[model samples]
Target: MKESGRKQGAASPCAACKLLRRRCAQDCVFSPYFPADEPQKFANVHKVFGASNVNKMLQELPMHQRGDAVSSMVYEANARVRDPVYGCVGAISSLQQQIDALQTQLALAQAEVVHLRVRQTASLSNHGFGPGSPNSSGSPSSKLMGSQVKPIFDMDMVVDQASLGESMWSC
Candidate 1:
């Protein structure tokens, strides 16, 4: 038993303990999440959040939550490493801009729908059929014979054309 214990110490330490220059206990908090083979994972986490803090967090959390916590830490660390300043905030801003653009497009589309309905109703009244006439399909109210009523503006195509990056916020 004593010989086995000595051999276990000789075995390679887990990434966390190796990076921190300490022996990895058999029950180390990092051992399950970070293996010895993936040193870079530990290095990234260590750089963003010190080893001691990470260890403490893992220890405090329940076993089921530790995996998700580790994954989140790695993702946040990568984003911070890439941006340094803005980090996740940059991503959120970009998404919000897209949402706003899409909403504006939706409003414009709704207005166009109303305009077509009015034009259809006028044409139908001329032909002795009212707006709610059972003779017509709801879908074709916007179409005048074979002519399709095109949208006044295409929201997605326009948003993609414009670069809503950091420079957009200046104005």
Candidate 2:
């Protein structure tokens, strides 16, 4: 009695045929488990089985099984490709949210700047020389002279100079 090359005793089949064990033809090597027509579906098979073994197994599958395998492979590959695109879309949406938040902050900052400028202008005018100053009612020269009132320190200086000469003579 010649023993077949197939490994025995492990009823657990490959991941792909595990769910549909009944659908898989008992042949084990190339049955429905190895769909060769779908090259991409079996793309990862080479990683598990050696390339030559996967090729030989796929080649032995029936034409209909090969076509079904190929279709399944394409669907799997498309899903893999879609995952990254979906992730990128999620990233873009988050970025847009951040941009919107920044824009709102910028708008608030601009409004605060305008409010500060208005307050500054109001304070300057109330102190009498900005655009709405009361000094506008007076003649320009009078307004200028009024704005330049003699410093109180100059009187102190004159008194100090007068006392200095007397103090020096006394000494």
Candidate 3:
């Protein structure tokens, strides 16, 4: 019988061994993670961490943990190759900046909505359909808008609460 066009007992060199130009033993540590088909995985790792360091790291870890260690090493190695100075930290900082900018934009949009609703309430009040007017019950839209807009526009109450050390957006 044969497997992958080689005899059953025959062994093909893994990526590490092939790149290093050496024979792959039956119990080679890199064979499981660095297969022959994905040579670049091992090449980048070898470039950043060196083959000896990878070998030592794998040999120091337990059987189950070695796979995770290899995965982390590959990710860090790839990041290091892409950005040698900052690596993964640069990516994280960029994402955090985007989040902060989006949050600021969201706050501005909410303020605009509140301003529009306040204008609508003032217009209705001028037409005798305001909350306390005799024709308040005649305009269902005005009543609903008045009820919704009051809480957001109560700046004095919000300022008082903030003075009491209560956070509005706290988790």
Candidate 4:
């Protein structure tokens, strides 16, 4: 007997239809987003929001927006499952808090950098590198001794983080 046109290696029903124990129609709503291999994804969505609601929402949307809507629903459903109280909002809030803390640290570090610069300028002024031709004590002998005093911070080692960030923007 000749074989029927039906391919022997046919694809199985999608997660939704399989979980619901129903035959997957050719135009099944969940087929595109939820494949047969990954039943957990559909289960997650189903657990959070029933399949009926998802189907209705998908049917109401325009074809162009459906894919994005499905992806968003899946992501939101996943987040909701993970975080019961706040879901995606909790994740966003945590990220924002981290950003705020980092910004505060950056401000402190920048202030310290400015302070170091001022102190360095003052130190240089104490030596021959400043105005009024060297030390405030008023002795040329102090100028000879000033050369022995080491700089607070090596100028070559000091990096201006703000300028570096601007350069990264240009790149």
Among these predictions, the greatest TM-score belongs to 4
By summed lDDT, the worst window of 10 consecutive residues in model 1 runs over 153-162
Give lDDT per model, in order: 0.71, 0.49, 0.75, 0.74
Q: How accurate is candidate 3 locally (lDDT)?
A: 0.75
The TM-score obtained by model 4 is 0.70
**TM-score for predicted model 1 compared with the true structure:** 0.64
lDDT of 1 by residue, 1-171 (tens): 343222365577789988988877777788888888999998988999999899899999999999999999998878788888987788788888898787667666655655655665576667755546665443333433433675342222333212333223333
Candidate 4 C-alpha lDDT tens digits along 29-114: 88888888989888988988899999999899988898998888889889999998898899989998887777667666766776
Ranking by lDDT: 3, 4, 1, 2
Per-residue lDDT for 1-171 in model 2, tens only? 433333454344444444233333346544344443444444454433444655464688776686665455445445545564464456567788887777666656655655555565465466675646655654333454575564222211222334434543341
CA displacement after TM-score superposition, residue 36 of candidate 3 (Å): 1.1
Task: Identify the candidate with maximal lDDT.
Answer: 3
Candidate 1 differs from the real structure by a C-alpha RMSD in angstroms, to one decimal, of 8.9
Better-scoring candidate (lDDT), 2 or 3: 3
TM-score of structure candidate 2: 0.31
Give the TM-scores of the predictions, in the order they appear.
0.64, 0.31, 0.69, 0.70
The digit string of per-residue lDDT tens for model 3 on 8-45 reads 55567889989999877767899899998999999999
By summed lDDT, which 10 consecutive residues of candidate 3 come out lowest? 155-164
